[model samples]
Target: MKEFLCTDKDFKDIAALVYNACGIVLGEHKREMVYSRLARRVREHRLKNFSEYLAYLNSNKDKEFDAFINAITTNLTSFFREPHHFEFLKHTIVPQLLNSNKVAKRVRVWSAGCSTGEEPYSLAITLADLFPSSWDVKILATDLDSNVLAKAQAGIYTAANVNGLEDKTLKKWFLKSKDGHTYKIKPKLNKNIFFKRLNLLQDWPMQGQFDLILCRNVVIYFDKETKDTLFKRYANALNNSGYLFLGHSESMGKEHSEFKNLGKTMYQKQHNARTV
Candidate 1:
């Protein structure tokens, strides 16, 4: 009715809405960010106001809540992100795996919140480089957003996707499209990687027990309680000496006893031999 600008109440109301819908907590300082992100929903819905849209979200019997969450959760990632983590995966983790014939034979890596494919593709390339001829590499990349998963499965990306790659690496791993602007990972590179649509809120499909899990920058949007629950579940899913990689900002902290830090944001399964 009146000219609308998002207010504190609007921000709190949205925070509550998002939390209920997806377990994300929009904290106090995020008032402006909440406003900025939801403003588009207002314009798109052409509602009378923020209050009206909020009401609509509340009353709808069944809506595409995943799409709503995907709309808000920022999906920013790149190939070989936090390169040191991959380095650790290669040099430190894989060396231990090599010693144990049981764990070394087959490697299972889960890119928990793989955005548009770069992260998992990066893992595949790293595996190709680090453990070539190791046909036992099985990589699973997942995202809650079906839209992003679709793009991830296709493995084709615009020029912007190659953000931090060297020309030599790009030339080695990607094939420029006939049009010359787009590129895709060569099919040979796709062997180890599989992309699937998954939501962290839902029960994980596979009986995990994975060698490594990469849930980087994913749960930053989730509330603390949700984070604890997810991380505990993650711990359970890992093998006795498996590893977990969180975003530089997302730390396991003292909350979970199942893991110990391995420098940087990297963590090791409690049973693993200590790193110097």
Candidate 2:
């Protein structure tokens, strides 16, 4: 491997490009992090340094750009990474939605920024455990990074990925590979999940509203204005009385008439009638 030099100018230019392309605000401090990620791309393209890489990026408008975004985007998630949210879903949210005649029997969940499938899969497992019957359940798992989306769609994981799951849950929801080194989500669990590469900053192609939207730990990277815009979009994307789960550090700013904080980074859509 050769020593790759990334100038201050190069870092700033790349950071600006990233912010303009997506809403992710990479602060000046992220220069080293950016270098660490994109350096491989720079080498893969056989470029001399970061300057040449940025030059290439400026000239291209194709898959490489997607590759660039995929390389830089952070994807840190696991099955029930935020366990309390799943608990809330299983204990309170799902039961009420399913039992209420006023609400639709069908359930729709969007795992926005679903990295490598853990969040949506956990939701699937929870629903499967709770319902256990033939129910109309659809989960749309989307991420800006196509690479992670590919991995998410595969529904496969290493043994470590299933670490904290209960034995019965593991046996019921995942099938151990013949070698016992990998586990794949059972087909039944995979059926309801629809994985797609979706940039949250871009227009959402899906038409129907979601009953639950888990955009956890995602908007923390966005600026305040971007967060406000995205939260409003989340409000619009959810059905009446739907729930929005944010990252622990993220909030809905001041109270919005459309949504009421249910605490623990959960917000309920305020319709004509409050149901939570």
Candidate 3:
């Protein structure tokens, strides 16, 4: 990879571009990462420095800008990620929703930052096993990266990616490939879950008072203001007392007063005067 130096002006422009294009506020510490990943683009385009790259990101009619957003965002994911959330969803949430209302028959769970298919597929399996006879469960999975979205929609994974799972869950959720070295989701589990290209910072186009929302391990990249706005939107999108799950390392702190913490990484929307 080619190396380029990012000056203060370069940093400012790059931060603004990332935030505007993807709602990701790149902090000062990630300056080197910007230079490192994007420097290759400069070299590939044979541009001289970060300043030139900034202009290209602004002026290019091509995907130099789109490619930058794609490169800057992280897309790490796994099955049963932050596994306690799944346990909580299965043991606590599903039953509550099941007993509550007739509309509850249609369960809409979202894997909000669903990177690949793993999280939603895991949720689908849990829903299927929970409601074996019902065909009403749905998982709305979304991500910013179209590349990962395509891979996620395909629902194929190398054996190594599925390593840290109980044998039973693996067998139920994935079909062993002909090579016996890879895994793919069976259509039964794939039916209700949907994949869409979404950016959390933008106005949400889908209306959902979803029963459950899983936004794990993605917001750590955003600045505090971005996180605050996104959480507020999430609160609005959820149903009455709808459950929200965040990453194990993340929290819904003083920033938002509408959500009450049930336990680590689990939250419930409180009774708001208008919403209730």
TM-scores of all models?
Answer: 0.86, 0.94, 0.91
Q: Pick the candidate with the highest lDDT.
A: 2
Q: Per-residue CA lDDT of candidate 1, range 1-276, in tens?
A: 334566667668777767875677778877666666666776777876777767776676367355456666777888888999988987888777667645457778999999988899988887786664753878999987777888888889888878668999889989998887788889988877888887787778897478899999988888778988888878777787888999988887685777888778887778743322
| 53: Cα error in model 2, Å | 0.5
Candidate 2: tens digits of C-alpha lDDT, residues 1-276:
537999889888887878887799999888778988999999899999999988898789574899898889999888998789989998899778778623446788999999999999999988876663666788999999988999999989999999988999889989999998899999988998999888888888989988899999899889988888888888888887889999888888764667889999999988843222
Off by over 4 Å in 2: 101-104, 132-134, 272-276
Candidate 1's displacement at residue 125, Å, is 0.6
lDDT, residue 94, candidate 2: 78
Error of 2 at 257 (Å): 3.2
Best model number under TM-score: 2
lDDT of 1: 0.79
The deviation in Å at residue 122 for candidate 1 is: 0.7
Candidate ranking (lDDT, best to worst): 2, 3, 1
Task: Rate residue 274 of model 3 by lDDT.
Answer: 35
lDDT of each: 0.79, 0.86, 0.81
lDDT of 3: 0.81
Over 137-235, each residue of candidate 3 has an lDDT whose tens digit, in order, gives 788999987778889999999999899878887777789988879988878778788999888877678876788898988887777887887788788
- Decreasing TM-score order of the candidates: 2, 3, 1
